[model samples]
Target: MPFRIFRRVLQLVLCANALRVYLISHSIRRVIIATLGTALLLQVAYFASVLLLVWRAWCNRRAVEGTSQRRRGSDYS
Candidate 1:
């Protein structure tokens, strides 16, 4: 099973490399432009997702801290 999986993955890598070569040879300019656009969009999406997750985590942490502070204040009283 592991050998089969490795063989399949290797095949896919070879096929992808062949297709990349063909694309680059066919129209390098268009390929470069498209690749850059795709990379930029991917980076923007990744950063936005990360920022949103961090914001949510920060909010949750702040809320937990606020609740703990209230509990401590009540305990002191």
Candidate 2:
């Protein structure tokens, strides 16, 4: 348990130092940040498109099912 805590503390210190250096160095940070941002934007766009398609498909399936159910009930009456 003690060793685990020590490892975590060491990792935090290293991350803080790296972040400070990244902030101090403008050019490298900008390129890294821009690439990450673009990746996130593209992910959001892809997710939205997939969700819209699934929603349309669900609605179409429900409509078809509802009509078939109505037709079956009418024939039995």
Candidate 3:
């Protein structure tokens, strides 16, 4: 009977250890996922800013060209 009780205790200790390890690993996985999500968001924001700058530059160039053409036409007339 004593041997049986000792064996049960040993099993409980092993189970508890496994549960602790699993919890630690789960928490670590969550941290890694959060870090990756933040990095992806930052990258998206960087690209969006770059695209906005390029679009503004293109519009400004078109406006300047249009004004210069109008001036040339008026001068000829």
Q: What's each prediction's TM-score? A: 0.63, 0.61, 0.64
- Look at candidate 3 and tell me the lDDT of residue 59: 100
Give the least accurate 10-residue stretch of model 1, judged by summed lDDT: 9-18
Candidate 2, number of clashes: 0
Question: In model 3, where do residues sit more than 4 Å from their true spots?
Answer: 1-26
Ranking by TM-score: 3, 1, 2
Please give, for residues 1-56, the per-residue lDDT of candidate 1 as tens digits.
25576457655654565568556688766656655665566557657877998999
The runs of at least 3 residues in candidate 1 whose Cα sits more than 4 Å from the true structure, single-residue gaps closed, are 1-26
Which ranges of candidate 2 are over 4 A from the true structure? Answer: 1-26
- Writing each residue's lDDT as its tens digit, candidate 3 over 1-77 gives 25477457655654565456557776756555655565566557657877998999999999999999999999999
Overall local distance difference test of candidate 2: 0.70
User: Which residue pairs in candidate 3 collide?
Assistant: none
| lDDT comparing candidate 1 with the true structure | 0.70
Worst 10 residues of 2 by lDDT: 9-18
- The TM-score, computed over Cα atoms with residue i paired to residue i, of candidate 1 is 0.63
